[model samples]
Target: MDYIAENTNFKLKNSAVTLGKFDGLHLGHQLLLEQVISLKKQGYTAVMFSFSYHPGNLFSKKEFELIYTEEEKLAKLRNTKMDVLVSYPFTKETSNMEPEDFIKDVLIGKLDAKIIVVGQDFRFGHKRRGDVKLLQSLAETYGYRVIACEKRKYKDSIISSSEIRKELKEGNMETVNEMLGQPYSILGEVRHGRKLGRTLGLPTTNIIPVSGKLLPPCGVYASKTIVDGISYPGVTNIGFKPTVGAEKVKGVETYIFDFNQDLYGKFIEVELYTYERPELKFNSIEELKQKMQEDIAFTRNYFLKLNEGNNSSYSN
Candidate 1:
């Protein structure tokens, strides 16, 4: 995938484009991308137009914590087979452009877009003054096509990155994973820790999450970690280790089962599968160790059941 800046003065012949924040690339965004990919197969170049920052963040006083940080968002987009990724920084002047000018300059003049795929409720231009109807209205004059994707659903609620963020903060891992079509994962480099787990017989590699990335509730979880192209069963703790002391600096410490090679400085991806228990401050170090043993046991059983189900399916 080729990444281009927004202000780049370049023109293409024909392209199929999708526009969105694509924060987490949730099911809804995936549906739109699939359409772009299909259009590319039909001979148009696939392009994705996204803002480096959320448009809403431009006017809001409160800082927005992204579901996936900007780097993570780009990483996910690179995995797709899109021809071009145009990322532009949002600015006051850009936001104040008229709907018509945006169409003529951005859609037609810059990208030479032949087709645009957007959600039914998609909006653009100054103060979100543009909608799908406006796009359709200008389609013929601009010589482009507009495709509106219907809302995607998981269970009763429509799937969205905002809803997923709220659920993750509330520790609803099961639903988060269901709507995401995969486990809720965090990617970070393994950092040096207090080595407290080693003393307790459950060694763990500490993780320092990317700044401004939203994290799940502080607790222990039945999780798995992927390292160097291999997946391993693991247990993770996300929070300030209350039992160790009163320091509240948040960190993710994961103990990989059946593996003990040093991992400091190596990056790892931890997938939270199930919530085991909340962060507890035990009265004694012995008590903490006992509870940690229970967490490991639960993690092991969870993977065992998962593997058993896999075997059962293959046998059938």
Candidate 2:
């Protein structure tokens, strides 16, 4: 797989290119990617053209908390048949380019796009001046095919990254996970903490967050902790501890319910299955421990029911 920055030195001929931030690789993005990948059977290169940073974040006051960072995005796409991954630098020059020039230069001239796949709502080039109509009109001149994938829906609701983010922010983990086509997860290295969970008698492995990553919510969750390819049931807390003195940083602390082993400095992944409760400020350490005990009870029952349901469904 080729990783090109700015523009490729060599023209990528007969490429099937799709453009977007592809933040979460949600169902909508996956639908478009399927179209891109399908073109590979006809000998076209599968190329994903996305900017290094989301364009919205550059102009808007709110920074985009990405579901998948650059590394995570690339890692997620690794198993797919994508041929080239280009992170075009989003700058004033690129943003100001006219729609025609973007098609003529970046898409046709620079990337050598043979087939372009995008959503009907696709916009590009200078204040979102380009749309599907413009690309369709120029397809004859550019000598390429245009595939416009319609909006995808799940359970009669339109699926989008923003919608998923909304669900995540509200701590609707089940719905968010369903939209993502898999478990919504964070990948990071285990880091040292204050060993406070140890004091509570539930020693935990602390996980550092990926820079600018979108966390599900600041709370406890029923989760799975994956370390070295082995998964363990876990109860995770994500937030700055208000009870144990204020800390500026937010972190993930997971107590593995299945196994115990030294995991400091190990790169691990945690998948939040369900939101349990919000972070609370307790008056005393004992009070905090009491709530944590209830949280564990809820966490254990959640997984047990999940397991029983799966077994029942399988037996049926």
Candidate 3:
């Protein structure tokens, strides 16, 4: 797949494009992506057009944190059938573009869009005036087809990135994963730590999450660490090590089961499955060790049950 970002000289032709922030790329966003990808059979290039910055950040003092960073988003979409991914640079001037100009200059002019896909409530352009209706209205003039998808819901509530982030902040991994259509994962390069886990004979791989990346409540979680594409069950802690000595930046430290090969400087994805407990400051190192052991056991049981369920379903 091709990635276009920070540069505007590249061009795509005969593209089926889906436009959105695509922050979490949840089920609702996936529907729009599916629509664009489906047009590939007709020989149109599947393109995902998103902005470099979250639109909310431009208007609000409370900066919007992303469920997936640009790199992480690329990693997630890299495995998909997408032909092109464009991260349009967002600026005041870009935001001020008139709705029709956006349609003309970006869509029809630059992308050569043959088909456009978006959600029913999708909006864009200055003062957020554009909508699916506007796109459909210009379809005839632009010579492109407009396809709007209905919102996806879970238990009658709309599935969205904001909702997923809310659940994540509350450490509701199960609900977040369900809404995401996959595990909520942190992808980063292994960083050097104080080796506190090593001192306890329970070594772990540590990673510092990128700035503006949303993380769950500082706590221990049942997780899976993907090393070289193979997933290993793990007990992960997402926080500063308060018991040993609190760090300035947050980190993701995971103890992968049955594996201890050197992983320093290697990039890995740690997927959270279930929340276990909050980060605590133990009175002594022994107390911390005991709690960590318990967390590891819980993780083992969690994956064991998951495997059993998968096996049962396969048999059925």
> Model 3 shows how many backbone clashes?
0
Report the alpha-carbon TM-score of model 3 versus the true structure. Answer: 0.96
- If scored against the real structure, what TM-score would every candidate get? 0.91, 0.90, 0.96
lDDT of 1 by residue, 1-316 (tens): 8888755567766999999888878889889999999987789999999887787688897777788777666766777888888887788888899888988998888889899999998988887899999999999999999999998998878999899999999999878877776677788888878888898888898887876788998899988888885788889999989888855578988989999888888878888888888888889989988888899999899878877777322111
Q: Pick the candidate with the highest TM-score.
A: 3
How far off is residue 267 in model 3, in Å? Answer: 0.7
Colliding residue pairs in candidate 1: none
RMSD of each candidate relative to the true structure: 2.8, 2.9, 2.1
Model 2 vs. true fold: TM = 0.90
- Pairs of residues at least 3 apart in sequence or in different chains that clash in candidate 3: none
Q: For candidate 2, list the clashing residue pairs, or say none.
A: none
List the global CA lDDT of all models: 0.84, 0.85, 0.90
Q: What ranges in model 3 sit over 4 Å off?
A: 311-316
Model 1 lDDT at residue 284: 92
| lDDT-based ranking | 3, 2, 1
Per-residue lDDT for 220 in model 3?
Answer: 94
